[model samples]
Target: MTSAQVAKEHEGGEGNRPEEGYERGLGSRQVQMIAIGGAIGVGLFLGAGANIAKAGPSLILMYALAGVIIFFIMRALGELLLYRPVTGSFAEYSREFLGPFFGYFTGWTYWLMWVVTGMAELTAAAIYINYWFPGIPQWVTALVFLIVLFVANLISVKLFGEIEFWFSMVKVTAILGMIVIGLGVLTLGFSQAGDTAAVSNLWAFDGFFPKGVGSSLMTLQGVMFAYLAVELVGVTAGESDDPEKTLPKAINTLPWRIALFYVGALTVILCVVKWTEFADEGSPFVKAFEVIGIPAAAGIVNFVVLTAALSSCNSGMYSTGRMLRTLAENGEAPRVFRKLSSTKTPALGTGVSVIFMGIGVVLNYTVPEKAFGYVTSVATAAGIWTWLMILVSHVRYRRAVVAGRLPSSAFPAPGGAKLSWVAIVFLLFVTGLIAYDADARVCLYVMGGWYVALVIGWSVLKRRDPQVTARRREPEFEKL
Candidate 1:
């Protein structure tokens, strides 16, 4: 078959309908920043302390290694997105490459995954607020923010994009500010509030990797989890003004993003503070300022952390809403989910996503402390599944490419099969490691159960819809 024939086979024949809802509404800049913003989450700000404790200074290398794996994942996704730029990107790819059953399962699985993440984001907002008031109930706080963001999403897609733009900007500014400030402290050799130590604190204690390779392995869970949402770029490709233009730019820039955002920030912190101190205590970002004897650093970092949570919440809402609408488009969900409001946002889909997040309020009300970690683990598990699909999709896409089916395109993910296989191995390893850890073991079971449920659901869906037996086919253009 020719490339065009392959495209047609992928989209379910000539009768495959063009999308009616949601125009190419976002700018290239908005798309770029959204990708950057979505990838950099509160984990880097808050979870780094735990990672530092685990690998000692070697946590940096762990993040770098994880980034390499993630880069492959994104590259595979990028290739797939370039092939079929649709609202239901990943889910659609699963259907095209694997089969309808695979598509239905992956689509709904991803939708549920983001719903869990959205809930976790709302719950996190409450915890961050408590650092300030310490009096208000976390449930109330979570609900209020959820409702507010829900309304923002309902009003317009543009508003959601705008809000996310600024929210992401806040996160970027804070991390960049910390990097700049940390660099100054590193070079000038300023004294921390609690310690009169010099800038060699990073290696001064026991040298990097104090816990050996074991600690580094332990820390991979946290760092990789933080990077889980990086592929939100592929998800956003459908709504972009031009996927051909924007998606490639975003995917190609992954390396710098990993370096500057993850590596750069952690490097500065380790240089300024003793990894042992942060491991023994808490929040290296906040503690670094306290060490410098800045009285209000905690307050400032708290505010920044609060913004980070809100940013994640905003992105979560955006991602889940899109995923739900994509599911609807694929006939896996109710047709109502694919409907867009006058403002071109999936108003109903957005509402449903927020309602799912509202469940977080209940969790916060009933079990405030454990709610955050529980939801985070669940979200992580779901995200891992989504990434696994992306890897699988890429492998299948490459087979098509080699079969003389796919045209060369921008935004290529290197290491084709080799990296894809490595990423799959790493994913399984992460799951196994999670099983080993007392806290993360539950996620393994939860994700496993979720996939099983998805498979059962897929069987019912295939049985009910004879049309799903048809394959999706796409048209090919020779040049970009």
Candidate 2:
């Protein structure tokens, strides 16, 4: 079948479609909050300290530049979502526009990305818990938090939305508060740690690029990791109550989010407390509040960062389940995963994902110190693949549009296919940066093995179920 026919077959039947199994319970407010929450992860809250230490204030420019590229990628995704919103999102786009192999690879690779990402988040959550409960073992904390979040996700999508809403509110409120307080300190000439708060602090101790351009370039891996989950909003298009309105509004705000949460907040922190004061091991936000003599600053910042980690974990569980269900629907995964609960939740898929996340809990026990860095590196590399596929799929989608195989999108991407190529090159450069770092090179190696394994698994599945493989090759949808 042609790509156009495939799109119509999967567009959710008029009245009694199997797609109805997914509850469109996420309202505009929840979606907006999910977008905000996805953009701001524990990376910004905690990992920024290391980047700032390495790049000094030049980290702001890194974020701004990366944010622009990310915006182009999102616009590309937005155009595709507007063309045909589906629960599968990028995976579905890849299937129709690129090819079935790409579709399979994108779907499963994305699922693997989130599963590992959830592991990293769970590790961070455990570390954060140690700040308050030094007596607890890290593995115990990780396991407990994983179970709690897994249960929360299994209940319903609405509950997931509510949990994310409050979690995002905490992160947003904390950043805004820090920005306001940092500005106040600068204007009122508050002195703390024998250094007066002033904009001059950005350059007084050392120039913005204190470590040189090469050193700043080294931090791009971590900087990109911070933006890992930002495109999660596209995943929500399947369940959003008003995807036509909410998806655009949520995506359009990417620029300001980078400005305020990343650039604006980092500028304030540097001005309030010199970048020299931040260490690679602790949160700059916590240290800034501490230097300013805020009582319980460590505890407060710890609580906020903990919520940020949990929020990411929660989102991971939610997205992995949906992606798996999409795979099953497309005959790329086990049939059992296609079943949804009466409440329209992918209970089986979520349970399976949580089972895999248990490996993270085990790693916390065996390699607590290295688990976060290792898993995060792998997740970042996996994220690069997912983003690259989005750009590729969008390019193919535009070709289909021009060839009269698909209609023009209501929310067309600016610059169209050319911008996608630019973004693709930017992603490649970042991947190269990852290879340049001896510590991060492991991620690429692991990702190489992962793709090899996926090819083997795909081959095995195809041989075992020739009919399902044939259906996948033909590009026509069948009713569940």
Candidate 3:
């Protein structure tokens, strides 16, 4: 049968798993790059300035500590993905291990998270474009980028993968080049900045915690936000060529990617120029490059950050569609969302998501400065919820396996439930920190509203289409 036909055949019943219908066009390299790209966003490029102004050199410790928690989260997710790799990701696991309500909430919450994130990325991309084309309106650039990525995602999964691969390559190359240059300044004294380039810069400025320990602690909100999309790899499992192998490999590399990109890069930048020299005005990378006397430093770094923005927007386009499809398959969303196009893509759902994402262009046109910031905290909270579900689901899945109620996974997480609990607690602590921040605390209230909305939505779904909200049949271990 044709793939779409097969996909249709398997639908209309809860017997099939959520990941079955899509094409596995993503290869190992694409999966790895997606993971890397997800980990590295414009947050590092631009947002770091404000964070540095808050935490000083101690920001490195926050990223490192959070990085460890993120690793545990991914390892837990990795175990579940190996057992039942699906595009539905944590949303699906939540359904199986938690219940239909949680699955429904996670699926829709993830969809909202990416849709808003797409808007933010588009806004960021448009602003970066303005640096080069001063007359082009932010809304115009945002619309153009949204259309390009939407079309790319619909054409085929492979095209989406290729677009992301190249986008991530630009980001990876820029960070690597900057690190190498920074090291040269420190060791071989390559640049004029080398005159003062000393690792001691990390300590010389206010002894690392210049703003006090509480100030450093407060940067956790931004640090965790920077780590938001690393879980994108889990969603790629359904479309990956060999998920069992690729997913684990993609997740395993997250620690080094976090280290090199966040911790290592920051260490070098802080070493090359003390944290005190950094400001919340623009990219520390751009400023450092200018200090190093690199030609067109602003322009080059702008291009890189622009790519960072577009890369993330592209990912949002790709993932939101899949999340919608997963929700549809579970009857939590409209039935039409489950349909696959000739290219084996969720065209309808993706198009709907893109339409909503267009609101970002409008926001950019109107609010320009606050458009991205307004939605970022909500997105971070949504991400934290997604991670919480993954850890909880993994813990539950492990317990079932140990009880022999379900077979063990091919890839088991080390330290099992204990590690998952640690990650969960750390995430909760971050959530508490978010609640503590006056400006950020509003997200908690927003999320409170979101939860009530979900509760209402769930009640409506269960009443209107009992089948849509039907509990999934108990999971069956795959036959060897």
Write one digit per residue (lDDT tens) for candidate 2, span 78-125.
988776677868787777767777878888989999999888788888
Off by over 4 Å in 1: 1-19, 191-199, 279-281, 469-480
Candidates by lDDT, descending order: 3, 2, 1
CA lDDT of each prediction against the hidden true structure: 0.75, 0.85, 0.87
Tens-place lDDT digits, model 1, residues 348-432: 8778878877876676567756656777777777778888888997887777677766665444567677789899999989877
Top-lDDT candidate index: 3
TM-score of each: 0.91, 0.94, 0.95
Candidate 3: stretches off by over 4 Å: 1-15, 478-480
Once fitted onto the true fold, the runs of candidate 2 whose alpha carbons sit more than 4 angstroms away are 1-11, 14-20, 191-195, 467-480
Flag clash pairs in model 2. none
- As for model 2, its CA RMSD to the true structure in angstroms is 3.2
- What value of lDDT does candidate 3 attain over all alpha carbons? 0.87
Q: Is candidate 1 or candidate 2 better by lDDT?
A: 2
